[model samples]
Structure formats: structure tokens, C-alpha cells
Target: MTPPSPATSAPTPTLLWIDASAGIAGDMLLGALVDAGAALDDLQSAVDAVIPGSVRLAAHGVTRAGLRATKVEVEVLVDDPPHRTWTTIRDLLVAADLAEPVRARALAAFARLAEAEGRVHGIPPEDVHFHEVGALDAIADVVGSCAGVEALGVTDAVVSPIALGSGTVTAHHGVLPVPAPAALELSRGWDVLAGGRGELATPTGLALATSLAGACGPLPALRPDRTGIGAGTRDTPGRANVVRVVLGTPTRGTTDAPVVVPADAGPGGTPERAVVLETNVDDLDPRVWPDVLERLLAAGAWDAWLTPIVMKKGRPAHTLHVLCGPEQATALGAVVLAHTSTLGLRVTSVVRDVLDRAWVAVEVDGGTVRVKVGHRAGRVVQATPEFGDVAALAADRGVPVRQVLAQAQAAATAAGVVQGAPWDPVDGGPAPA
Candidate 1:
């Protein structure tokens, strides 16, 4: 596979910020997107590609607590099947004739639901049966929502803290808490709130939200060109029971620290900003710390680490620190909250001056190890071989890791990938040695 490289010509991605402050459901989100201009016919066509004439979708404008909103209702035309297993659902999606992205998104959402259900019921994910989510309407909601998102051309999404609701409700498993166990499981690494009475967020809804969501935070700075409101069943007396969608292009140089930096930055290095999310945990199992860090990095954190500390009453703890792009603050914060015993997170925006860098591949023994070269003012300031590459080469050749590291260092130096060497603008450094 070719190595990763920075994008040089991609267009600025469009942002779809979902406001689930009131709550969210599969149909609620779909309605919001439709109201915001995602064509309903397109959604129906996509759903038909999968279920094929089994489900129908229609939308109408209505008022929820004095606010106008759209409600898209799913009507099943055929006899719905009994509870379906994750394996069955997976096969159906794999054979679906939908767009690649739409199919992929739907599959991901269902996969999350299956995993959550499996964990809650102590069954393997493939063997877990989806009861409520297996219903025809639920299937329509999941598939149509994915298709709606694609129709709008939304490239990225951020979700606000979700409202899980209060009280209890009855379901296929009998009486369950407001935020059903499966929903709660799926919401593990997301910001959530109990915004109202009854079940505001359902498992299917949370599955879709968490699957599509890239981050969780307040709406970033953007010039919204379209807004849509989707109403839930109840038109509660006071508050509007609705989900909101805001579509726009992110505005740079505004609050929430834009990722794009101005070109006039000083010569010392390029100045960019990142957010630091920190939290302290004392009650978590120590054995799980490594997994926590791994999850954070996998979730898009630039870096994650732990610092030991002592809390009140001499209790020992560790403060988890996550450094990430501003856009990733809430998402990474959610990961920390989910994996650790922390009840809150502290977010701080920091400006960093970073040197220009490039990658160089050098032969160590017979293996290639990529070296990261940092430079400033057209001079190489630092050069270091990637440890992952070095370790792999050591394992392959059955040599001591240190020996491989030493040889890689010498190879880099011989290749002029050293401090103070004139930087090569072509691909950031000299060609591989």
C-alpha cells in the first residue's frame, strides 16, 4: 500500500452539525436532513435498493411546541420479518444495490447496534438478534438516513451532547430504563444528557448518531446556509421535541480554533492550534489504561498519555491527557470519559509552532525504515527513524532492536538526513538512501 500523505488539493469539507440537545432518533435525524433539503425521493430510492419495495417514506411539515418541523414517516408494505441476526443483516447490506458510501454508513450503524446488543445480552456479535431495530420501519430509518446524508453532500458531521431522557419504558425485553441498555452501550464514547421525561433517544437513534458523528461539541463557527427541524411524536407542552440540523461551511479564524492557519506565520515554523483534553481518574482498573490510550489514538487523538498524581485524602490517580485538533476535542473527550472513571473533562486550546517535516526511507540491513526529518529555515533540525519500522525490521532479521536502531541512525546520517543539513524542498528531505 502507498504511504499516507497530506492532502494538497481537496476542497474544504462541508460540516453537518446535529443539535440533539432535545434528543435524537433515526426518523428525527432523517426528517431534519430532508427539511434541510435532502431529497426524500432519493432516500426512498436508496431504501428500495436494499429492502426493495418493502418500505415507503413520506414527509410532511408540522408544528412542535410552536416551532415548524418536518416529520418523515416510514410505512412498511410487506410482512416484516421476525428478529434478525447481525449476520443476516450484514449479508443483506453486502448485497444491497446502494451507493458505496450510503451502504457503508448503514452497515456501520447496524454493526454498532449489533455490538452493543451482543455485549448487553452476553452473546457474540454475529449471533445477536436485533428485535426493535430489525423491524421494517427501523430498517427504513437507518437506510434512509444514510442516503439522506449522502444526498446532501455532507462530508463531515459533529454531534451535540445527546439527550438520553429520564424514566422508563417497556420493550421487547420488557421494562427497561429510559436510556435502554443497548442505547447506553452504544453511547459509551459520546456526550449525553437526560434532557426530558420518557425515552428521547432510542438504541437505533444512538447507533446512527454515533456512527455518523466525527466529533461531539458545540456547533463550531460556520455560516449556515440551511437549517432543518425534525419533530418527534410528542409535541410536549413547553419545549420542542425535535432534532435540528445546520448545514454550512466552517468559518476560519473564529471561535473553536480553526484548523486552517494563515500563510503569514513567522519563519520559526508553521503556527497551528490544537485542543488539550484532560481528565483525572482514580477508580478505573489499572489494567485497562493501555487499552484506553489505544482507543484515544484510534479515535483521532494526535497524542495521548497519562500522568500520575495524588488526589484528595491521599488517593492516587492518573490524569489522562489528549492532544488533538480543535475539531476533535469533543470526540476525543468522549473517549476519555467512556474509558476512564472521569466525570468531566477540561478542554484547553493551545497554539503550537511546528517545524516543516518530511519523510525519508533508508535501508537498514535489507529493510526500509522511514525517517521523519524536521527542518526550519531551509536547514534540517532533527531526523529520527520511525521506531515502528525499526522494531519490525529487528523482528524480521532476528537482531537486537538496538542494533537495528543504530544501523538506521547511521544510514540516515550517511544519507545527509542530519541536523543542520540544507533542507530539500522536494518531498521535504533528501531521497531515500
Candidate 2:
């Protein structure tokens, strides 16, 4: 038989599944990347570019519970650098001459950390002081790991339930419980295990995992191509002190194929494949519906809503429906199952046809407001101010909401974004006169 032509076969999408069952830390994650074929020299060079000559990186082969792994060590050479704030770190990362993707990933990971720290300390994220995590070693670990991720070309990431470990850990702020306040804050809404002794998941590890992974669950069906074990420093008895990363190609379902709608379709819209998950509940407290809707949206539901209905025996009920991308179906479904009283849910694949829309920022009264433009056949069909931005501007300026809306629409019209007449403030509506 003649060999299949390479051009005929589609390239498989790469996925990196992290097994944090033993827990995760920044060094452990970097070590995992090193073992999985990310070039240590490249990682070192990237870290050097970001943090200068403040730290040295080393990767050593080791075994955790008879399983081979890689251990990464970061040696800080600088003598007690000033405690940096979140703003300082963000400025440094943004100014560094790094690849755009690497810079973005590093900044996102740090932003997650900053947000968690800010929440824990009751302060703004920009003003949050980084104590131990602001050190050169932490910087190297975070930036180097992100660089490695970029180098490996791993596009999708999934994390297993993290083992949080138990007990107490002392920080610069004082004696904090195991899993620390920052770690706990980061792990909120994430699957976490509190078994085992001492700290398993650090704040850095939680931040990186939560920031990078789009979904959290058991390993999806995939054909494993490579595996790497990252060893942790502590050796708790009866368990392997390592995090495992598996790289593979998904064996189930289509690989994110875009469903293009025909030009003759209604409204010349582009339709994308999505899944609709739904359930009906008649017994839950009505006060919790708002929170449920909010959680579903936060958990990656593109849109979620509740509809009033009549259940058996004329009992009033609600039908909760969530729309999301196909990849998030399972995770979001789990969210519904966990948060609601329904024992089961209905999932159906759907195609959502939408107009070609773009967001453009318009300056109004000192602050920038975003306006959404919907186009059909390359011509603007509808232009509207984002209500959230309009409301914020209105509150800040102590003006009517309609006035802010008019100003934003007028700004959009002035920029030639919309073809028709602008909204008139005097008439409080779109203008033709």
C-alpha cells in the first residue's frame, strides 16, 4: 500500500494534561516542562531577558517514588531586592522584550496571582504587595514556565483536581494555615483536595494552573505521545511527590472545526457550533436563581437564562439553559449538576448564527467607552453602545444614562463607524433632522 500523503492528513491539535493529584508548585511545573522537551537553555534565556542577571536556573533528573522526574532549582544571586508591588511587576513584564505570546501568558499568570492576593488582603490588585512571591526565584519560575509552554506549542491545557495538602505554613505576614490564604483564594471554584500533610499547592502554582487551564476535570480521551514528571521538594510518605504532564492528541470529537454558514443563509450571518445544556428545577429557592445564573456565566457559559414554566401538579418551575462552546460542555455541565438540584441535564449541539461584530473604543468625557458595531455584507447594520460602559460613564459623570449613550453613539458616528445619522442628545434618540 502506498503511504498516505502528508498533505491529505490534518495536523493533530496538541493538548497538555496536568496531573496535579500530588499538588503543584512553580518549580515543579517548570521542571515538568523541562522533562517534556522544553529547552532549558531557551527557558533560561527568556528568564534572563525578563529578570536580568538576578537568578540562575538548573534542571536535574530525579525519581519520586521510583518514578523518574525532573527537578528544577532557582538560585537567586541578588541580595534581598526591594519588595515589589503588583504594579512594579506588571510594568516590568510589560516592558520586557519577549515574544508576544510569552509576555501575555506570563502577565496573565501574574495577574491571577495579583487578583488573588488583592482579594485576600482587601486591597486593589495594583497596590497589593508581593512578599515572598515577588522574589527573583518566583519571577524566574513563572516567566520560565510560560516560555516553556510557548516553546512546546501546547495550545490546550487541562488540570486534574489539585491536592491542597493540610497543616500550617509561616509567611512574612505571620503564621498562615496550610494552603495559605492566597492559595485558598486562587483555588476557589476549582476542584481541590485537602488530603496529605503540609502545603502541596502553593499560591504561584494555583495562579498558574487556574490562569492557563480552560477546563478542570479528569483526563479527556486522548492518545498520549509524551509524558514528563515534575518532582516536588518534599517527600511525604505513601504518596509520590510529583506532578505529571502528558502531551497528546485528542482521540474523541472534532478538532474545533469552524462551521461556516452559507452566504444565502438568513441575514448573511456566520454560525458557529455550540452546545446547549439545560435543566428544569421546581423546588429550589427563588432567591438563588440570580447567583446560579452568575456562576454559570462565570464558568464559561456564553449565555445563560431561566424561563418560567409549570411543572407537575401545576407547580411553578424554571428552565435553566446555558450556551457554550463544545469543548466546555462537560465542565459547564458539571457546574450545573453541582450547583442545581436537578439530577440530570439535557445537552444538545447547536449552531449559533451571529452578525459580524467588532468592538471599537470611543473617547467620551475623558474615559474610553466601547461600542459594538454589527456589520452585514461589509456595511454597518447596527451600532450600539455597550450598556455596561455607558452606565459606568453615566455614574462617573453624574449624568443621565441616555446622555452617555448619545455621546458614545455620536462619537462612533464621528469616527465613520456607522453610516446613518448619529443619536441626538436634544431629542434623546437617533437623529435624521
Candidate 3:
């Protein structure tokens, strides 16, 4: 079917420009949204949907680097908040009664955090357990930020080039560099810099900004509506350690649709460097292959797979392949050597072009399934429902998995996530503006 032309009457999407030049954190962004006129009640209700009275949101006026701003604190109501895995949190969000946009944004943020943490520590994304990031306060910050943006009627977001910091800081994994591995990993493909001393941009903050905004660069042209400043924990000398959120409408003759663009890409696309490690083994136990692949993934390998091949003696064997980043080549190579029976391996450097991707949630039979959407040049090219979610929903509802898949695809299409559809991640269409 032919697609409809851009509606002349369709209102321009409200643009949310995140100014993180000073740096950002979950609290800082949340506070900025509140200071910019996000309803406190709406933020509270959204947090309560998933965590259920676990945290309280409070905002107050403050000064940072001699600049007055707002600081929102997430107070934990319970003693010793439990650490949650990505799976546990994802399930909680899927079952919660949240606005589609809020839920989708939160889920996407947490998902990015999980992937970054997993790669940093060498574990499967779902199996990676959280420490500080899984706490009640962080959860509140993520949920609150998402809800606050929706409350302000934001339809699209554009984040400034991030301000990563210098020096060293300690985390759940012990003392790490200023930016932290997870933070750096999350900011991959986006513009970033060492903005100051100490750890400025945090994992939670980077995840929220990267996942929600998609577009990264200097502020685009827009007629400003409201500007809010969010204060960080420390009022450092010589700089305002804060994040500023600018809410506005697109200027005339300009489109407000935001698409994920790689910071280092050329006109068509950019090629990224990666290493492929491969080895053929005929004597290893077949049962051990699965464990070997799992270990490789845990060792920061992007992917691991096995192919059937016959050796010189016509013996049936498996050829294992591991793909990883260049920086991870040594560590992943060691993992490959230790797990497999092969004494040697073939290593090749390769370049790959990647499309921009994001996640959105759709409801099927009252259950939520996340759909992974891929975009290029500001238009959606592909949309696919996560089969794991589809199967789980099918099992819970006592329905065939295929039926759930069909429903999810249909829902995604109806929500405007199909190929050639205009880019808008929020379900039920863009927030009323």
C-alpha cells in the first residue's frame, strides 16, 4: 500500500533538547524536567506503577557553581533495596501499568545499561545483575525522567554531545576510569568528550540520554519554550555540574522527527572495526560447545556461533567463531583458547556498517512485547517483535506463540513502526501537543 504524504495539518513534534555540556546523571535530568514544568503527580504515578511505593520523589531549588537549579531526589522508602537483574526489571516493567511512552523509554534505558554492563563485565545481558544501578533510587530516576518528558508533552528529543569526565572513580566493579567502561560503552556511536575532572556523566544518565534522544549533536534550531537547569550532587568550582533541558517547538520549515545518527558516520554509513576469531576442532565434546559460547559472550564477545565442518580425516567437527571489538581482542582470545580444545585460532580484522536501532513496547492481549525497530536516513527500515517476549506472553495467556507473534506484529504496524512509516517511538501516537 502507498503511504500517505506528510500531513500539512499535522502539528510539528515538540522537541526536547538535552543540554549535557556540563555533564548529566539520572537525578540531574529528572530535576531539570521537574523544574521545566513536569507535573510532580504524573512523575510520582509513573514511578509507583512499577516499583509500588518503593520510592518518593522530591524536588527543591538549589545552586550549582553559583547557578541556581533544581535537584530532584529519589528517597527509598524501604530498607536495603534489592539488586535486580535486567530480566527481573524488564518483567516488572512489562507487567506495570505505565503509559506506553514512559514504559518504552524506561525499558530502553535499562536495556542499554544492561548491555553496556554485560560487555564491561563479560556476561549475558539478561544474566547481568545490577548493584548501584538496580537500587531503588536509580530505578526511580529512570522512571521519573521518562515520565517527566511525557508529562511535558515531548514528542522528539535531541541530546548534545555528552561530557564524559576524567580521573578515576569506584563502582560496583571496583575503581574504574572517570567515564567508566559501562558509560563509555553506552555512549558508543555518539559524540562525547572529557568535559572535566572526575566522573561527570554516569551510566544511568548516559543510558537515558542515548536511548531516549537517539540524535546526538549540537542543539538544533527550535523556538525555545521552557529551559530548566538540574543541579548535580557536587557544586564544583569553575563549572556548573548540571544538565539543562530545553523544551521547544520546531522552527518553521524544519521537521522535528528525531532519528538515531552515528557520530562518526559518513553520508551513507560508517564502518566500525571488529575482530573475528575462529578455530576448528574435531575432538572436543559436543556438550561443551554451548558452555564455550556462553563464556565467550561473557568475555565481551559480540557474538559466538558454531558451524559444522569436516576435517581432513572426514571426522565431523564444529568450527567455532567469535566476534568482538578490537579492544576486547586479547581478553576474548584468551577466553576462546581456554574454553576450546584448539591449540591455535585464526584471527581476522573486519569492518561493519550498522543501522540505528531502538526499542518500543506494544500491548498484545494485555501483555507487553518489545519491538526492535531499525532506522536509516530518518525512516524505519525494519521492525521485529522480540520472540522471547512473545513466547512468554503466549505461555502466560495459554495461547499459541504464533498467535501472539501475529498480534504483536499487527500492533506494531498499527502503532506506525513498520517500514516507511514516519518515525515516532511513542505508542498511541505522539503525546498530544
Candidate 4:
């Protein structure tokens, strides 16, 4: 009788948790799902759209093993159950016309299960036997969930501790241990809770939740847009046996902008959320530059670089620039002192009108170049050419590095491969690289 933790952090990202102590088979989950209010009809249409031929997913409200729930069953026209292998799943997905990455994720999960089953049974990873029930049920859960995600437009999946109901469950291998082998194998490193009268986390839940979540960890802050609760068959005296699916966006309170300063230390300041630390030095050992950059990176600087320039009176000086989050000011200064000979470093909290960035490979005249495209305020603001790629191609094609860099940029822009910004200052702009 523990009071539910005070409405934890206001939901930020979409998260889901399954409390399966009473017993959560597919049917129970489907029932609770109806109660949780997932758009079952919409999901059905999505499945049909994604998978050819009329597909009907039966989601009817019901109770299981003395618990109220909804039952979901999908009936596909008679055909071979489809060979149940990693590639078998792959080919079915290919023929069904589902999304590529979605198909890949499901296949990877199946491959993991096959691997674990192989290890547990001492068989080849590919040769592990999956019974007809297991294969059909796994496919239904994986593909359906993928379709649901696509319908929900859920980009990320996070999970809470899976409460594993203890006791025996019958599988094709005859009555086996709770969690079964496949489920146990997938549960490694995740928080698992047990203390029920039946199997809580079934293999289907294990494979789906663990594999797609990217990483298993505690629920992150999120904004709940929708809450869908799927039920387990067990009904403890005072608890609801269910899984909760919360969908939402990330709340933005995790970051705080530091006080701003004038760009040139003049009378006023400019708008910018990012900061830069810089200093000029002519009286330092050149041997320390590499170590200095490394320490800056270790200290969490977004970028640290030294630009060689001719100083006043014809002396050669190196300008060190460190770009970082505003909160990084104190730590970066310490790093500067520990690694460099500069006694004073100028700090500026300036707005970095940054653009969303994505990596794209463009076909340059000489060869291929991986260009990073950036966008700001919905317009591409920068396209930074990959330096090493240009250098390598230039050397190979007997062309000047500058020419190679230009060609790469042109190619990236021509193909519309990099959507956002292009690094305008060709020889400028440094990163933590």
C-alpha cells in the first residue's frame, strides 16, 4: 500500500511502463490498452495502410483471469505462417511495404531473441527453433507496435522497471520458469521488479520494450500528450494491473541561459545562447597546444582550437578559442589555466544562432564528401565541409585542397542533400574536433 510517487516529474518525453505482476499476456495488455484509450481504430487503419490486403485487428473490451481488460487479435488471410527467421521477418516486412528503419528495428529484436535462445539451448543462433505460436505472436506484437508508433508519431520510447510476476508459465518447451528464457535474456541491465502470482514480463514485452528503447533507464522528464493504459490479468487487492503508455514532448526547463555579455566587451550585449572563451598568446610552448585542446574537450568545451596569426609588430601568435554552453564558463577557465600559458582569457556569452544539423554524403567531382548541414530558424544557415574528406580526395585526385573543399560544398548544395545551413566562412568555424 505505497502511495504512488507524487505524479513524478511532469512528463517531458513519451514514456511507458508495464506493471505485469498479475499476468500480462497479449490479450490482457490489449484490454488495458482499450481502457488506456489508445486509438485502436486508427491503429487498425494504419496497419492496413502499411501492410497490404485487408487487415483487421480485433480489439474488444474484456476482462481476463478476473481482471477487466481489452483483447486484441489480428486475423490475416490464410497463408503460410511465413518462415520464422531473422531474414524471414525481414522479407515479410519488405513485401508488406512497411518503413525500412521500422522493419529493421523489429528484425534486430528478433535476431537478439534468436541469439539468446540459441545460447540457452546450445543451438546455432540461426537454427534456434521458434514454435508456430511464438513466431506468429512475436510478429503480431512487433509489427503492430511498430505501426502504432508510426501512427502515434513516437520517435523515442522509454520504459520504467518491468514488474515480472513470479510463477511458472507454459511455453512450447512445456511449463518453464517465470520470464521464460527469451524474456530473461532481454531483461539484462534493465530494472526488473518481481512479486506477483503469475508471469509479469512476457517475452513479447521484453523483446519489444528492451530492443526499441535505444537504452534502458529510468523515465525521463516528459509532457504527457496521451496516456494509454494496458492491463495485466492479475488483480492484486488494491492495485490496478496495467501498463501505462504516456506520449509527449520534452519540457525545456533542464537548461538555463547564463547572463550575457557584450561581444567585444563594448557598452552593450547581443542575443545568443552559446558562449565562447578566447585568448591570444605568443609566449607559450608550441608543444602544449595538443594537450591544451584535449583538456578543454575533457572539460566539456563544445569546441577548442588555436588559429595561428601574425600579431602586432610582426610576432606570430596563436589565438585559442573555446566555445561551450554558458554553464561551462567556470570549468573551462580552470581547464585553460591547467593546460595553457595564458594568464588571461576573454569570455563572451554570445548568441549562437545555430541551425539543426544533419550528416549527408555528397558526390563531389573528385569523390565523396560527408558534409554537415545546419539550419537556423527553419532556414539552412551553414554547410560545413568535412576537412579530412576533402584533404584525402584532393591528394588522391592531384587537386588543391581548396578546390576539393569547394567542389564538395557545391555538390552538397546541388543535390539538396544537406537541408539546413552551410558553413559560410570556409577557413573559419572550429569545433571540439
Better of 3 and 4 by lDDT: 3
| Candidate 4 structure quality by residue, lDDT tens digits, 132-166 | 54566566666666556545555456566777766
Ranking of all candidate structures by their TM-score, best first: 1, 2, 3, 4
Strongest candidate by TM-score: 1
Query: Which ten residues in a row are the worst by lDDT in model 2?
Result: 1-10
lDDT string for model 1 (238-266, tens) is 98999999988877632453555547544
What lDDT, from 0 to 1, does candidate 3 have?
0.79
lDDT digits (tens) for residues 1-433 of candidate 3: 2222221222445788999998889999999999999987889999999999788888899998889999988877877677889888877876788765566677768877888989988999888786642567678888899889878888668899999999999876588888888888998998999998999999999988987774787777889999998999998988999999998897753335434455666454634566798999999999999988876775446799999999997899999998865534544554555456787789897776665567777878888888877665556777889899999999999999999999999988877778877664333221222
Could you tell me how far off, in angstroms, the CA of residue 307 lies in candidate 1 after the best superposition?
Answer: 35
Q: Predictions ranked by lDDT, top down?
A: 1, 3, 2, 4
Candidate 4 residue spans exceeding 4 A from truth? 1-56, 63-69, 75-83, 232-239, 253-433
TM match of model 3 to true structure: 0.58
Output the number of the lDDT-best candidate. 1
Residue pairs with clashing backbones, model 2: none
Superior by lDDT: candidate 1 or candidate 2: 1
Model 1, clash count?
A: 0
Better of 1 and 2 by TM-score: 1
TM-score of 2: 0.59
Indicate whether candidate 1 or candidate 3 has the larger TM-score.
Answer: 1
